[model samples]
Target: MTIQVDENEQEPWTVLRISGELDLVTSPLIRRRVHAAVAGGRHDVVLDLSAVRFCDSSGVGVLVAARRLMRSCGGRLRLILPARGAEDGAHVNRVLAALGVRRLFEVYEDVPAALDERTAPLSA
Candidate 1:
């Protein structure tokens, strides 16, 4: 299935809300969006993957690359992945956890939390 990525802003953070299957064909789209964000001098980014139904290795790779890119530019990258409820609340969350990379990111349960500078990330 095709993926949908919606870009928006939450103050200092650029929120990228992604939905649908994240596979080889669609992962590049996310990667490009991230690059654009970084190139535009917007360092802080929030990747909201709560709506993502499926996530593959390529998707994981893109997330990792995005994280790396933000770090290289002295920017911060945060993720939104609900830790409880059905299916771990997000497939991407489970995928990242299963892959042992979930702990590498600062993850929030929702957009508000992600955007809030005072809030701490959920435990991995």
Candidate 2:
């Protein structure tokens, strides 16, 4: 499947909803889109990965790099990952966990939660 990253703003956050598979071929597209968002002056970012069906190492690398970029700018980065039982568990979620990189991110179970400032992120 192809990847689609749409940049949108909701108050204080820039929501980037990513859909389709995220593998080596499509991951750089995602990375560039993310950099574009930040370069366009967006600091609070949320990656809505609920529609993602697969995530390879390249995808994970983009995620890690994005997190670092956000931190470097004193920006915020949140992620929407399916809960443990949803969609047999989100592909990116599993990939992050297996790679021991899940704890590096602020993950949420849904968009609403990720966007809500009052709601704390899920423990990694």
Candidate 3:
């Protein structure tokens, strides 16, 4: 499946809402978006992965790379991943955990939660 990233802005945070499958063929597109966000002077961003139905290892790589890129730029990145639901709840979460790198990111159940500065990032 093809991956589509839609940019949704809410002041200090720029949300990249992702959908469809994120695999080898489509992961680069996301990598570019993350780069572009940093290039455009955005240091705070959210990756809304709640709508993504599938995520392969390549996708995981892109996420890890994004975290690195943002950190290199002194940026903050948040991810929206719904908790334990029958649909669209935990695919990315499981992948990140399985790879033993989930702790490197800040994950939230929704956009509002992720965007809240008062809320501490989830334990890695």
Candidate 4:
């Protein structure tokens, strides 16, 4: 399946809403987009993975790399991973958890909460 990534600005953060399968073939697209955003000076980023249906190790790697990149640049990275059963939940979330890397990211239930500076990440 084809992966679609839509980018938008939410004031202090740039949100990237990704949907479809996240595997070896499509993961590079995400990495490139994140890199481009960083290259363009956008540090605070929110990855909206609520719509994602599947995620593989490559996708997880990309996410970890993104987090690392943001930190290296002194920026922040957040993830939107809706709780299970909430509109199909977040497949990427499950993958990250299974891989034991979910705690590395600040995860929120939605974009609004992720963008809110006063909000806190959900437990991993």
Q: Rate the local accuracy (lDDT) of all candidates.
A: 0.90, 0.88, 0.87, 0.90
RMSD per model, one decimal: 1.4, 1.3, 1.4, 1.2
- Candidate scoring better on TM-score of 1 and 4: 4
Best by lDDT: 1
Where does candidate 3 clash, by residue pair? 103-124
Query: How are the candidates ranked when ordered by lDDT, highest leading?
Result: 1, 4, 2, 3
Tell me the tens digit of each residue's lDDT in model 3 across 1-124: 4878899889799999999888999998999999998999998989999988888899999999999998999999899876644377478887888789888889887888888888876664
Model 2, 1-124: lDDT tens digits are 3988787889788898999888999999988888988898888899999899899989999999999999999999999999756773377888899999999999998888988788988987
lDDT of 4 at 61: 90
Name the lDDT of candidate 1.
0.90
How does candidate 4 fare on TM-score? 0.95
Model 4 is weakest, by summed lDDT over 10 consecutive residues, at 84-93
Best by TM-score: 4
- As a TM-score, model 2 comes out at 0.94
Worst 10 residues of 1 by lDDT: 82-91
Model 4 pairs whose backbones collide: none
lDDT of 4 by residue, 66-93 (tens): 9999999999999999885565746777
RMSD of 4: 1.2
- Residues 3-115, candidate 1: write the lDDT tens digits: 99899987788999998888999999999999999999899999999888888999999999999999999999999997746574377888898999999999998999988
Please give the ranking of all candidate structures by TM-score, highest first, separated by commas.
4, 1, 2, 3
